[model samples]
Target: MFTENATLMLYVENVQAEYDFWKTAGFEILSKETIMDYDTFDMKPHADSTLTFKVYDKAFIKQISPEVADFQPSVLFETEEITELHERISGLTDNISPITSTPFVSFNFASPSGIYFAVKEK
Candidate 1:
């Protein structure tokens, strides 16, 4: 049996850009670390954090790439104001689109850094 859940992680070329992307998309940053000269970024999170994203450099990937990946991260938010959140996000980022209802009531959008997200009513 599984002992715990998993977290999504990504290797990014730009740490600040990726971090800011999640912030704008409504994720709270639990913690972060950066190397001034190396331009390296390491991020840690609190146990209770709902959504967490970590951005690191290619060098970091060199060590973990065999097992890990350079995949993009996506997180869905459950919301009652799907319509409003969709419109508000779209207003700021052209990548956002209108709500798409199917098996579940939801709206889809892209973050400033190009991560796709969907919001559903729970």
Candidate 2:
């Protein structure tokens, strides 16, 4: 059995930069702590779940899991103002793709740390 609280941890080359990116994108900072001498930031895009980032060395990560360096994990978010949010993020990150429609209108963009996520209209 699982509890309502859940967290997704993403190891990044720069934890502060990733935290800043998400904070600027409107994700609320829940807390911050140090783990294994590495800075960790806990944030929440919505109240249901928490997203955490831990600082990691790219070289070490590559040696341990080479695929992780190139891996782009998709995190889907629902937004009421899809166009407005997309336009706002477009000015910040250049990795945003054109809005696409299949089942619904959505677009994907990468954070400053190159973590990709999708935003769909709710």
- Writing each residue's lDDT as its tens digit, candidate 1 over 20-74 gives 6655656556667654443443333334654345566645666656455446666
Q: Candidate 1's C-alpha lDDT?
A: 0.61
lDDT of each: 0.61, 0.75
TM-score of 1: 0.65
TM-score of every model versus the real structure: 0.65, 0.78
lDDT of 2 by residue, 31-88 (tens): 8876556666777786654444343545455666787755545578889899889988
> Please, what's the RMSD in Å of model 1?
3.9
Q: Pick the candidate with the highest lDDT.
A: 2
